[model samples]
Target: MSKTLHHGLLLLRVLSEQPQGLTVSELADAISVHRTVAHRLVRTLEAHELCRRDHQRRIVLGTGLVSLAEPVQQDLRTLARPILDELAESTRATAHLLVRDGAARMRALMVVEPRGALVHVSFRPGQTHSIEQGSGGVAVLAHGPHREGERPEVSEARAKGYAVTTGEVIPAVTGISAAVPARDRTATASIGISVFEYTDLGQLGTTVAAAARSLGRLLD
Candidate 1:
């Protein structure tokens, strides 16, 4: 790709991470470009409505990006609804679908949740956490290249085709997860259910793995 286009895309990525946006100087430093070069790229993005300056004169992603993302998110929710609902019902736990961010920090993207019981563990949409923390994260990690310093449980999850963790992210809550196979070389994702300690985890892991397989098939 041309250097000019690469710089513009780089600016977009750096801006997306900063919810409060970034000053021109910050953007310049992030991209290893001079302030004038960053400004030129930002102007080109602004012309296409891909980026905008906020009231504080910090650069932010513009509404055009939201238009691009909303339809994709809606389609993903539609595809996962039946599988997530089934997983939640079968296990009597709150079911979730998490995707990897593919960023430097390996954040887990909270994509879907179907509540199981009258009282269920609720993680809000768009929530993110370190990919090393819980069962859902480990499940996705099992499908990818293992990195040094990763939790040892990922290996067991890879061996068993499922992962289970207790009170790791939330005290007294248990998480059972399975990796959803990728489609066309896309990023790997996971499906999980969070339940109380009393639930029969052995059975639930099997159920979750089945649901994950079904969801993975749908992804194709």
Candidate 2:
């Protein structure tokens, strides 16, 4: 890849971690580029409306990315809809599709609640949290090679083909997830369900893992 393009992408990645925005000097330091080069890159991004200067002169991701991302998100939702709906109905819980953001965060891309279910967990899409915080995150982390000092949940997920946790994302709730394999290395995602209670963890795990494998085949 061209050095300029590489640095530009790195700049955007760095800016994504700081929702409040970052100064050009801080951006340069974050991306290991010179201040002048960072300025030129930021200006180029600003021209494309990919990044913009805030009132405080800090650079933040611009609205342009939303327009670019919407269609992709929609397509993913469309492809996963039937599977997620089946998972939700079979598991009798709220099923969700989550995608990795940067290196340490997971965002819910879509959510499906079981039809005719009374008193099921319900959460909106776009919920973002630490990659280590919940079953969905750990399930996604289980993809790729194992890392030293990784969480036990991740290791367990890798071995068992699914992950389970209780009260991690929300109090009194249980989550089960399995990683959805993708052809693109950069595209990390998971399929999961959240419930208030469940007696058969093994069955739930098997169901979710099967759903994940089905989705993974489609994604690949």
Candidate 3:
């Protein structure tokens, strides 16, 4: 396969395992390449915020994916901005909007940061995640979000209505995500929230579920 495709798939596989985002070195070994090569591959993914570097020099999931998924969400933000904003204001935490590009790629976002910690923002619009790397990505995958006409794990999630991704994508980051069925069969979309992995644990689950419901209403 071409290097671009190779790295892209590798990045995806890495995130699929869990939210414990991979390090350049770890990712390098997974694909049987040199660390330097893996580092470069990660950088490519980073351009889309599919991965991010952490204090330990490890790669973590990013919030840059929201913007890339604008179309998939069908302008969920545009239509639901008021509700989303109110939720953000009430939660005082970051809120995310995400969608999958059906085997093409996945995108996410951390649209509004809590007013108190806007400076401590975690994700920006247009951030993309390697479907292979984080709970954010895996949440979509676990829910059987399609890619290239394949629904990976949506059935399981459909039976469950929500997917909880932890330590699979980002080591210190966890994400909770839920999908909103779409009219288009070719692709599917979901909305989720991500935060540092070290918080009260359950908080990640609770907040994400609430945010997802808030967004789900927009689509309905």
Best by TM-score: 2
Ranking of all candidate structures by their TM-score, best first? 2, 1, 3
TM-score, cand. 2 vs. native: 0.86
Over 4 Å off, model 2: 1-3, 14-23, 29-33, 53-60, 185-187
For candidate 2, the per-residue lDDT at 29 reads: 96
- Residue 116, candidate 3: Cα error in Å is 0.6
Across 64-177, the per-residue lDDT of candidate 1 in tens digits comes to: 776776687677668888888777777667888876653422333443444436667877666766677778788877777777877789988888889988888778888889
Clashes of each: 0, 0, 39
lDDT of 3 at 199: 48
Name the runs in model 3 displaced over 4 angstroms: 1-74, 118-121, 145-160, 167-171, 183-187, 197-207
C-alpha TM-scores of all predictions: 0.71, 0.86, 0.49
- Where does candidate 1 stray beyond 4 Å? 1-7, 10-36, 46-67, 101-119, 186-188, 198-200
Using lDDT as the measure, the top candidate is 2
